[model samples]
Target: MPKTLEGEIAADHAEHPTAANGAGATSVRHDRRTSVPRAAWLIGPALVAGVAYLDPGNVASNMTAGAQYGYLLVWVVVLGNVMAWLIQYLSAKLGIVTGRSLPEVLGGRIRSRWGRRAYWLQAELVAMATDLAEVIGGAVALNLLFGIPLIWGGLITGTVSIGLLVLQSRRGPRTFEFVIIGLLAIIAIGFTVGVFVAPPSPAGMLDGLVPRFADANSVLLAASILGATIMPHAIYAHSALSRDRFATRRGEQAGERGATGSGGAAPSGATGKIAWHGFGIRRGTDVAPELTPGTATAVPTDTLVRATKWDVTIAMAIAGTVNLCILLLAAVNLAGVEGTDSLEGAYAALGVALGPVIATLFAVGLLASGLASTSVGAYAGAEIMYGLLHVRVPLLLRRLVTLIPALAILALGFDPTTSLVLSQVVLSFGIPFALIPLVALTAKAGVLGRWKNHWATTAAGVAASVFLITLNGVLLWLVLTGA
Candidate 1:
């Protein structure tokens, strides 16, 4: 029989005696409460995960959409971001409540060995597709800025990502978060500055929000935009990031105990001690009171969840705004310009129209986006392998392996922008595999316990899933029939 939440808490506490005594936990909690700046420390994991949203695939897709369709697909970007906020919140909630990533949860639930392997196979492919976009984007940026060969540029991007991953592994998650967030800041400045220099027409922008498509090609760009924005890897990465960020550690319960008073009584509520278990929170006398690792005991489930919402909101706002700015910059300036649909062309045009400074900044932003996002993508891929396959591969080896496809694409002289847009389209097709399982799992009371999704949340997830699947279907039909 499966162990109950109470049993898990007892086992966890037994493994860490310091947690029960509250000896080491109090000072750690106090430091967290007193030392770090409130807003800066609290908002992180989402920002790291949000890097995936502003990846090279996003720039390629959005820029292509703007240059080709000229504000016609603004509704797609906005709608995808709206859906992304809800989806990301649920992913974070699952991690905080269950103390497991989406991949880890699915790994345990699938039951069949073959079935798990099959799921992992598709997820791994999706992750590879994500890497293809980021590495290529970075490579293209390097080529634009320094006149390097695409292959060498890809190799350099891959090398930098491995270094970033090393930083993540050695320095711990918080340090990694800080580093990625710094890159995110650079990405924001690089991508959005051009918009101020040449803003899209307000009337045209408003029209683009009406939810209509121009043609079959427009449908492809829409799918690519959605794919780039609401990424499968981001979904996988956020849950794990949340799990790692909020996992209860030794003496964490002491912080909560400290919060209630010296006597360690439950605060205000009539319930028993607040016990955090592996699966969910248990409030009663029956369960052993314990806290998990990584999170402070003083931070309760409600507080962490609230913080997560803010984290996700801020991250999404930044990602969404940058993505929109990328499109609008192109829409206002590059639309109808010959050869402006590609990243290289776009770079040249921006230089010609807006001066070399803006173009240089644009390349710099793309480079940052590629670097930060590829690191996060590699992280997600690692988590997916660990959670679903239950196998551990060195991050360096995984980075090398994933780099092959992107490097080959670059070496073969495939158009980087086209490859990026198509990679996102592949990511679009993979969305249902991640989204359906996440929505279904989070909706179950057995999974999240009291934190299960509300009816409306479930409905929204279902609607988003259906819309994305339908969009992919239309894209497939258009391609096959040459619509």
Candidate 2:
């Protein structure tokens, strides 16, 4: 939500040149900050959002696809990745345009007190559900690599992840972004090596990219893979992240200024509500007036948005490639191997088929995904809560809140990998809550102003949402009927 400097702001600045509240007081400050753009700033948000794509849930789901169905369901993974690109792009756009995250917009729209509370509660549940896969996934990797028990491994994961968040917090968002990007590299490297160790048949892999299911059961499995790949909490999280990362300098942290004698209340700028709404932008305005600190230059908002598109495209391409590799490796090395549908079975099979070293490398990738994605899940939880409640808490507290469900599952001694896969199916059920709202809100001119969603974008979003909903319905019916 970028705010344009209007006549009133300049006039106010002229009258109260020293007034902290005067937009004029900040005008020169902005002019000094908007000069140069960095590659890190441009691409950081998408890289952070892309972490969700490489999490443990994806590992289990993609592995299951390759192991159980071979290359038959690879198209579903591609479809889900495309859906993710769309979802993340729209989410980032909403934040960049409106200066408000999706949760903030949703909070503003939900007028009823109880209704907002209900939304918050449901979002919290979804956040916890999201955390289950990440936490369990990392723990499974721990067990695989170090012989740690599931419950203990989960505890270790929660503790280490929280520490990472706290450490990253001290280092600032730039450091955090680089850390996640580094972990993504770890994952990408693991799978790159995996491809060489157990390459899929060229003809079959190509055919797998075509949209066809081998059987009805594969349809159910495709739904599962699709659901696992496109995250619910991620949409909310990405918008907030983009809003934070790409926002103007002093955007939300410094509230709008006012003259001391004026006795007027300026909006709380916390969390980048530049214009409060991006709809109906003033005519002839080229960019947001507020400048990001560091550049003594003024850049157009359109350019900023264009930079975001580049970030999304590049980051998502890497994510999609890594995800495809997961399926390919599974299909080639472990899919038809007896019992390889299980994570443990797959690990053992990988050791037998390739070597223990390759299997361990796979576990290393899983470990990295588990650790990085859990941090992201916690971020999404905090955003959802703050979006609805407007309260911020310590990162550790948020991490602990999100970890409750994962800890409970571990305490019960459930199978870690099984629980992670089931958590993804649960994740599928929560998509509509986040996805439908994103599509609906972004389509409105009131929210996006000149940045309103394209007709084709809206159509595709709705179509995809409906398809997933229908697939979820089919899944539910089969579960109830034991089909």
Candidate 3:
């Protein structure tokens, strides 16, 4: 069965062309549903990889691990990136083929009632807990950069929810793209500047990339990196974003076209018979229509080609390089400090090793990462609500959900460094909760239609999932029993 919103939109459009069509015959709103061409799939990961780098939880994880172990933990980050790439590619393929996100596909299409409720509850908890980290981390960074009290910063960060909501409502999906790109640039520049001064040795850097098993923290930290990279939201966000680029029905056609020589239908005729699918936008509205329903009315091949794999791959590589640079910077500057357990300690040590100006820049980078990641987390939370409940939550309300924990964490007084570590732990703990369902959904041919995972892909995905689950389990056991 189609979702309530998809059904409602489809039925209403079928019933009332005039309502969907606008008062003036001069312009008409194309149906939002349509198949997308080959290029549209790139949009999601390109957008998400940027946001993932800037996420506050990720910063904390990278910063803390870097400070404590130096470049010794670089291997964990490398492995995490490789694993995340595999998972996200699998996730995007699932969406492109099946036309539904992981949660809904698992809940409504594939699972039993009990399974649906369990998955929903689990995903919701992960979303809520994840927001707390974003809010608190952003607030902490604000405190460091602006000299504002943590409590006030939390209040200010909480208020950011209103801004995010406004962006979502007025700017629509493009707002997400704009904010993520800007933050990614900010972080990239900061790392570049920082690394130029305190570069890691090539030998040490290579060593860092090798997996370490010398300590419990190393094992757990590796898990945290993987957990952070393969976030629950990335799975859903990738699917939703892909839909925005292409319609499910025409995805095969677009793929076949891209595979063959049909780069795009012979450019729109002089009569404009081949207009771009999901291309038109009137001023003042941010939400673009999905590509599938509208591809019938336009030239999707050209427009989608604009959102090519090269675009996404380049963006992911940049984000990955930037993330690696930040870890290298921390390893170089703060690795020797016995007490450098927190970002503040790392910042203070950076000021000594680099300079006050460099330290200030680090703060600026941290702040950018926090705010960017916070927006992604908040957006994921709102989208999950829309998909699960069939109604969108106001951005203002979602901000409150983020702010409450931020304010409490700041006001009640937790050690900022410790808090950062715990946030990474929380993210790690949540991974198995997200991954098991992802594996199950991908493996089932009936659920994914013709887009189901191939035997080799399923084997690889399941193997990865089980290895991660066991890794997470061992970490949990060690934490509990102090082994």
**How much does each candidate deviate from the true structure in C-alpha RMSD?**
8.7, 7.5, 9.9
Question: What lDDT tens digits, residue by residue, belong to model 3 across residues 1-483?
Answer: 223234434554465564333222112333344334223333544564446645666677777778778888787777666666656665555555454455545545534656555566666666766666667776777877877888787677666645654664555555556666777788778656889987788999987766666688877777766666667776666655554434333332232233232433321212211111111222321222222322321222223324434444665577667667777887887777866677777778888889988888877777776666776676556556555544445566657765676567778888865665566666666676666667677677665543456788777777777877788888888888897
Q: Write candidate 1's Cα lDDT for 2-106 as tens digits.
A: 133234335434655554455453233212221123434556889999999999999999999999989899999999999999989988888776666789789
TM-score of 3: 0.77
Rank by lDDT, highest first: 1, 2, 3
Quick one: ranking by TM-score, best first? 1, 2, 3
- The TM-score between candidate 1 and the true structure equals 0.84
lDDT of 2: 0.74
lDDT by residue (168-207, candidate 2, tens digit) is: 5565556778889999899888766788866779999888
C-alpha lDDT (0 to 100) for residue 16 of candidate 3: 52
Q: Scored by CA lDDT, what does every candidate get? A: 0.82, 0.74, 0.60
